[model samples]
Target: MSWLGVQNLGSRKFTCGHCGNIVASSAGYTRNGSNQRIYICSHCGQPTHFDVNYQYPDIAPGNDVQHLPEDIEGLYKEARNCVAASSYTGSVLISRKLLMNIAVREGAEEGKPFIYYVTYLADKGYVPPNGRGWVDHIRKKGNEATHEIASMSKSDAEELIAFLEMLMKFIYEFPNKIPC
Candidate 1:
C-alpha cells in the first residue's frame, strides 16, 4: 500500500471506530488502482476506509453507566460494540442476557427461565412504570434473534440499547446519586 503523499480525504474529525475516541484524522491516502481513500486514526493508528460515502467498522453507539457491576458493564459495552460492528443479532442476544443479569443483580433469583427474570423485574418494579411493554419487546426481539430465521436490523439493536441505557441509568446510576 503506497501512501500517495496527498490527502484525497478532506481533514475531518471522526470517532475512531477502533478506539472509540474522537480525533482529528491523520492524513488520508489512496492506494494505486483503488478508488477508496484510507485515513489512519490519530488515537489508535488503525486505518479507516472510506468508500464513496461510507466507513468501515462504523462507530458503535452507547456509553458506560456509572455504579454498574463489572460484569454487567462489560456485557453492556460488548453489546454496543457488537451493534457498531454490524452484529445486530449478537447485540440483541447480549442485551437479552443483560436483562437477566440486571434482574439477578437487582435481587431476582438466578437460574430461572428468561421470562422469569422479565416478570421478576416487572413485578418488583425494576422496569419502572409503563416500561413493561418495551421490556417485553426486548425479550421478544431477543427471541427472534435467537430462535427465528429473521435477523435483527440496526435500528432494532439501537432501539434496544437505547432502552437499556435509560433503564440502567434509572436503576443504577440515578439512584446512587443520593446520600447513603
Candidate 2:
C-alpha cells in the first residue's frame, strides 16, 4: 500500500497514521527488491507501512468541511472514518443521508422524499452551475449503494466525499469568507 514519506532511507518525515501527525521516523526498513517500507513513528512509536503498490488503509481523516451544521459535520467525519476502517459501503450510505441533511439545513422541508431534497438544492440555486452532474452522481450512487447487493470500492467512497467537500465549501465556506 501507499505510505506517505520520502523514498530514501534513514530518518524520514511522514504522516504518522496513529497520531495523525507529520513526524520523523526513528527507524524504517524496506526489504531487498521490495518497494514496501515500514517506518516507526518517533512521535507515537507506532508503525506506518508504505508500499508502491495498492492503497490499503486510508488513515488520514477526510478534508475538513468548514461551516457545516454540527450534526452534518459529525456525519461527514463518520463517513471519513468508514474509509479508514475499510467500510466503503457504510461511507456511501452515510453520504446519502448527508445529502438530505444538507438540504434540510438549507431550509428544505423535512420528511419529503429524498429526491425532493436534491431537487430543492438545485432549484434554489445552491448547486453550482454545471455542477448538477456531481449532485446527480451522488444521488445515483447512493441509490445503487442502497438497492444493489454490492460493496462500494474505496474509489467510490472517496469520489463522493470529495464532491461533498466542494458542495459544502461552496455553500458554507465561501459565503462565510466574504465580508458581511
Candidate 3:
C-alpha cells in the first residue's frame, strides 16, 4: 500500500512442491488478507501454493551413482526421488532395500534377517567396524518405515540419505575409482 500502490504483486517464480518443477505462480488474496501464490506445473500440472513472502524450498537430488550397478542405482535413485517428493517414509524403505542389495552384492547370505545383512557386512570387513552402528541406525529407521509404525521426518530422511551415499561410495564408487 506504500509506493507500489498494489498490496499484492501478480506473479512470481516458484518450484512446485508436488512435482518439483519451476514455474510462474499467480497471486491471490486470501480471506484473511494474506497473499497466497499458486502455480501449476507445466509438465505435471500440480498446483503448488506459497505465501507471498514464502521462499521456495530447495530440492535435494541426492548423490551421483553412475558407476554403481544398474539395480543398485535404480533403488538409490528411487530413494532420492522420494526425498525430493517429501515422501520420507518411502525414502527410508527404499534406502533400507538398497542396503540389503548392497549386502547381497557383497556376498552376504540371501534370505537372512535384515540385521544379518548388516552384521555380515561388518564381520566380513565389507564395512568398517564403526560403520556397523550407522548401518544399524539405518536398519532401525527402515524397520519403522517397513512396519508403518511411524513416519520419518525430512531431516531424518536427509541424514539417512547422506549416510547411504557415503556407504555406497565406500562400497562401490571409491573402490572402482582407485587405480588397481
Candidate 4:
C-alpha cells in the first residue's frame, strides 16, 4: 500500500468542554456509520462523540492521494526549477500547479477561486495585495501562451518567470499561508 496521506495526530489540543482537563485528541474517520475512537480523560470516562468535521484522516493506504505539505512544496519547486527545457506550456502548467497547491495548502474551500487564496495570503502580509491581481492576470496570459503555440514569445516567458520567481519566494518564506 502507498502512503495516501498523513495528518497531525492529536492536532487539535482543545480543553474538554465537560471536564476542565486538557483534552488530548486523536482524529480519525468514521467507519460503518459509527464514529470510531476511544477518548478517555483522567476524570471523565470514554467520550466517543467524534464529530464528522473534527475527525481528520490518517495516512490511509491508497493511490491518487497526497499529503498537502509535500505536494505543495514539490509543485513550487517544479515551477521554479523548470529551465529553458520546458516549453511555455510546461511553464504555464507548473505555475498553475503551484497556485493550486497554494490554494489547498491555505485550506481554501473547494470550488473557491484560486485568486481568493492569493488575495488571502496577500492580506496576511505574505504578499502585496495589489500584486495578486497582476499575478493572476499573467497566469491567464501564460495559459493562453501555452495554448497558442505561436503566441508564446521570449517577452512572455520573461514575464512568466518574474511572476514565478515572486511566487516561489512567497512559498518558501510563508509556506503555512499558501495552499497545497
Candidate 5:
C-alpha cells in the first residue's frame, strides 16, 4: 500500500503527535479488509492510522513557533491534533487551556477564574493590544463549549487556532528570534 507515493510496506517518515517527534515509522496493515495502514512512530511509539488512499497523513506539519516552554508547546500540539480530528469543541477547549497555560507561564497565579487569566495576559502586554478582541472571543467560545450545549464549527476552531498561533509567535517565537 502507498499513500502520498510513500510505500506503506516499509519504514516511512511520520510525526508523532504525542511526543512531537519526527522519525521513521514502522508500518503494518490492519487485518480488516478496509485497507487501513497503521504507522507507529519509532521514537515515541505512538501510532497513527491512514487509509490506503489517503494523502497527506502527516500529524505534525512543522514547528514554526519557537522558544515555547515545553508544557505550552505540548498543549498547542494537542490542540492542533484535536483540530485535525474534527473535534472542534475539543480544540477550542484545548486552545482555552493553552491561553491559561501561557498566562501562568508568564507569572499569573493559578486557581483564578478563566477570564482572570485572559485579562492578566492582556494587561501585562503578553498578547498584542489589538489581539485582545479575539482572545476574548476564544474565551467566550470556550465557555460555550464547556458550559452550554453549543458545538463549535470547524471555521470557528480554526480561527481560534490561528489567533492562538499568532499569540504564541508574538510571545515566544518572534521575541526569542530577534537579536539581543
Candidate 6:
C-alpha cells in the first residue's frame, strides 16, 4: 500500500535486504509484469528485489560501519567444511589446529611459514597476538590425533566449533586486522 517504490528519495533511499545498505537504482525500473523493483546498491551489487508497494521513509545515510555478517556466515560455512574434512583427521580438534596454523602461519618465526600471513598484518600494525591460548591445547591434541596417538571425539569437534565462533567474531569485527 506504499508508493515509495522509488529507490532514491532525494535525501532517503531504500535499504538493501541482502547487505542492509541504502539502494539507488542504476538505470533500474519497475516492471509491469511483476511490479517488483529490481536494482543494485551503489556500493555492493547484491541484486535487491522487493515488492513495489513497500514504502520507505526519510532515512539518513548509514554511519559507514564495517559489516561482516556475510563474512561470519561464510566463516560458519568454512568451519563446517573444515570440521567435515578434518573429522577423520582430528574431529573438532581441526578448529583448534586451524587457529594455531593461522597464528603460526602469520608469524611467530619459531614456527614455520605461519609468519607470512602474520607479517602482513604486523606491518599493518594489527597483529596483537591476542587470544592465542586455544592454540596450545588444540595443537597438542591435534598432533596426537594426527600421529595416531589418539582420535578426536565428537565432543572435541563441537568444542572446536564453539571456539571457532569466537574467532569468527574476531574476524568479523576486525577483518583486515585478523587476516582470516
lDDT of 6 by residue, 14-102 (tens): 66544555655553445555666555556666555546644322121112224445533443445454443434344444454455454
- Poorest lDDT segment (10 consecutive residues) of candidate 2: 53-62
lDDT of 3 by residue, 1-180 (tens): 212222244566766655666776553333345455444455576655455655333365555864788999889878887877678889888889999999998888799999998888888887765888889999999998878767898877888888888888887888898788
lDDT of 2 by residue, 34-138 (tens): 777777777887767777743235474568867888999999988887887789999999988998999999899999988898899999999999988888888
- lDDT score, residue 144, model 4? 76
Count of residue pairs whose backbone atoms collide, per candidate:
0, 0, 0, 8, 0, 8
Best by TM-score: 1
Better of 1 and 2 by lDDT: 1
Per-residue C-alpha lDDT of model 1 across residues 7-103, encoded as one tens digit per residue: 6466767787889888887577887777677888877888887776677777888777999989899999999999878899999999999998999
Q: Of the pair 2 and 6, which is ahead by lDDT?
A: 2
lDDT of each candidate versus the true structure? 0.87, 0.82, 0.74, 0.50, 0.78, 0.48
Poorly placed runs, candidate 6 (over 4 Å): 1-79, 82-90, 104-132, 174-180
What value does the lDDT take at residue 38 in candidate 2? 78
Sequence-dependent TM-score of model 1? 0.89
Q: List the residue pairs that clash in candidate 1.
A: none
Global Cα lDDT for candidate 6: 0.48
Residue 24 C-alpha lDDT in model 5: 78
Residues 42-137 of candidate 4: C-alpha lDDT, one tens digit per residue: 346434334443421111111111333677656544443342333445555666656656655666565666566566666655455567675676
The per-residue C-alpha lDDT of model 5 at residue 56 equals 30
Poorest 10 consecutive residues of model 3 by lDDT? 1-10
The C-alpha stretches of model 4 lying farther than 4 A from their native spots are 1-69, 113-125, 146-151, 174-180
The 10 consecutive residues of candidate 4 with the worst lDDT sum are 56-65
Give me the candidate number with maximum lDDT: 1
Report the Cα lDDT for residue 118, model 2: 86
Model 5, span 19-70: residue lDDT tens: 6667776554453445667776677666667666452333433345789899
Assess every candidate by TM-score. Answer: 0.89, 0.78, 0.71, 0.44, 0.68, 0.37
RMSD of candidate 1 to true structure, Å: 2.2
Which parts of model 5 have CA positions greater than 4 angstroms off?
Answer: 1-63
